[model samples]
Target: MDQDQQWLINCLNASLDPNHQVRNFAETSLQQASLQQGYGLALARVAANRELPFGIRQLAAVLLKQYIRKHWNEDEEGFEHPIVPSNEKVSIKGILLASLDDPYKKICTAISVAVSTIAHYDWPDDWPELVPFLLSLINDQAKLNAVHGALRCLALLSSDMDDMMVPKIVPALFPCLYTIVSSPQIYDKSLRCKSLSIVYNCSSMLGVMSGVYKTETTALLLPLLQPWMEQFSSILK
Candidate 1:
C-alpha cells in the first residue's frame, strides 16, 4: 500500500478507538483529509481492500459516502466545500462502482449510497455510462452481489430522479426489475423487494412525465405496462 493509503487506514482504525481523544483527533484529521484532492480515492481503496479489518473497511466506506455528499458538486446552493478535482473525479467514479460487489453488506450499502449521491450530480450528462453499466450488472444474474449493489443504488436514484431522467432509465430498468420481481425461483425475497421499490419509483416518474410528454412517455411505457400490472396484482394478492 502507498504511504498515504496506509496512513488513511491507520486513521480509520484510530477513528474507531474507544479513547475519546484518539477517536476525535483521527476524525478531525480525516475531515481535513477530505479537503485534499486524492482523499476520496484513498478512502475508496481502503474500503475495497478485503485484507483490512472489516470495521476499518466499513468506517472507510461510511466516510467515503459522507465525503461524496459534501464535496462532489461545487454548484449546489450554499455549497462551500472544495470540489473534487476533475482527474480525481474520473478515478473515483471508475473505482466506486466495482466496490458495490463488496462481500460486506454494510460496505456495499455505503458504496451504493455514495454511488447514488454521485449520480445525483453527474449521471447521464457527466456520467452517461452509469445507467448502462448498472444495467449490465443487474442483468448478470450470476453475480448476485453486483446485482444487489446495482439494484440498491438504482432504487435510491430512482426515488429522486427528474422527469428527463425517467425516459432514459425506465425503458431499460423496468424489464430487469420485472424479471427479478416476477421470478421467485431465481431471486430471493430481498432482491425482489428492492427491484419492486425501484419499479415503483420509476413508474411514478413515468406517470409525472406522461402529463407533459404524452407521446414519448406513452411510447416508452407501452411495452412494459402489462407485465408490471400483472406483477403488481400478484404482489397485492
Candidate 2:
C-alpha cells in the first residue's frame, strides 16, 4: 500500500511535469485516485501545499476546486460524485481574493480563472461576504485584469439577488466605480465607462423603483449631453 501510494503520488506529480507521457500518467493516476480510498481530498492537500511547485500545486488546486464545485451544488449534480471535505481545506474564493495582490503575474491570472469558474455555480445569499474583498481588488493597479475580472464576477453575482441585496452591494461598488469614471487615467477612464455601461444595461433589474434612476439619470446625463450638443452646434459655426 505504501509503495502504491508513492507510485500514485509520483504519477500525480508527473502529470504536472513538462514531459507529455509523464503528465498522461499523472492524469490516469488522478482518475484512479478519484475511484480509490481517499478520493479527491487525498489529492487536495497535494494541491494546496505552498511548498509544492506553483504550477503543479495550481493544477491540483484547479482539479480539486472542480470536484468541490460539482457535488456541492444541490441544484446541479456537480462531478456526479460524493465529495469529501478536506481536513485542511482552502477557501477557493478567499485564496483568489488574496491572489489579487500576489507579486506573480501567473498567480493573478490563476485568481482570475478561479473567479470565473466559481461565478458559474449558484451562490447563497450569504455570498456577499466576499464583496469587500472583491471591492478591494477593483483598485489593485498591479493586477488590473484580476480587478476587472473580479468586478465582472461581482456584477454577475449581484445581478441575480433580490433588491435587498443591491443596497448592500451598490454602495460598496459605486464609490470605486464612480472614481473610476471620474479619473483622468486612461485605464481608469475605460474601466469606469465599461462598468457603468454594464450597470445601465442591467439597471431595470434593480428592485428599487423609487424614481432613483429617473432622478439621478436625468441629472447626470442632461448636463453632459446638452453641453456636448451645444458645443457641436457652435463648432459648425
TM-score of each model, paired residue for residue: 0.94, 0.58
* Model 1 stretches with alpha carbons more than 4 Å out: none
Q: Best lDDT goes to which candidate?
A: 1
**Candidate 1 RMSD to the correct structure:** 1.6
lDDT of 2 by residue, 117-220 (tens): 55555334434456667777777666676566665656555556554455445545655655555554635544665666545533444525336555654443
lDDT of each: 0.86, 0.55
Error of 1 at 62 (Å): 1.7
- lDDT tens per residue, model 1, 35-134: 8879988988888888999899888888887888778887866455788889988888888888878877778888888888888889879999998999
Model 2: clashing residue pairs?
15-23, 70-78
Candidate 1 lDDT score relative to the true structure: 0.86
Candidate 2, residue 119: the lDDT equals 51
Model 1, residue pairs in steric clash: none
Provide the lDDT at 23 for model 1: 96
